[model samples]
Target: MTEDFYCDEVLSDKIQVRKVLETDNVLAYYHTKPFWPVHVVAIPKKHIPSLITLEESDNELLLELLRVIKKVATMVTEENGACRVITNLGDYQDSKHLHWHIVSGEPLKQLFNERLQ
Candidate 1:
């Protein structure tokens, strides 16, 4: 995988994604490869490497991203009764892009096991 799949693939149109929500600066979409039964990814349209890399100027963007996440999470939770909002950092971050996952239901154990290896 490339260092920034969001930029190199999704944003660039190299890979197509089913969008859940989209604004000028934020995008929420179904994960290309989902780990949970209901997994949606929200990201800033601009390239921000990761959460830790966000600058003061990015505060508005961050809020917009969170708003989209909240909407997606709410939709999932209303249907599933519960959901999780997750983000990975440092070594846990596989894509190196600032993204939040809104998911519900038990994770797919097979996907977790495969990623561990």
Candidate 2:
């Protein structure tokens, strides 16, 4: 992600979403292959590769994004009683973009706990 970013060429086919809130440096939207009943992706508009490349200047934006995660979690949990906030990296993550997968549901919680162990 440290290198140049190519949006139209990079995500032209991966994304099934057209609805988004794009900033000068990031993109936020809902996920298509939802792990839970409610799933969305909060990804940096900039290409930063993964979370490992995070710098000090990215702190404020990350914090603000987290706050949004909390709000969404509350809403999702209110309806489902629990939720998951997942940020993947390296080989484990399917996507190269640094993003948060916000998901919630009883079944999802079970899946999350199973993966933890």
Per-model TM values vs. the true structure: 0.91, 0.67
Candidate with top TM-score is: 1
Please state the error at residue 37 of candidate 2 in Å: 1.9
The alpha-carbon deviation from the true structure for residue 76 of candidate 2, after best TM-score superposition, in angstroms, is: 1.0
lDDT at 112, model 1: 74
Error of 2 at 13 (Å): 10
**What are the per-residue Cα lDDT tens digits for candidate 2 across 1-117?**
423222443355443574335555555566655667678677666665678888888897777667666766676678878778888777786666677877766456678899999
What is the C-alpha local distance difference test score of candidate 1? Answer: 0.92
lDDT of 1 by residue, 1-117 (tens): 579999999999998899999999999999998889999999999999899999999999998998898889889989999999999999999889899999887789866787999
Clashing residue pairs found in predicted model 2: 1-47, 1-49, 26-45
Candidate with top lDDT is 1
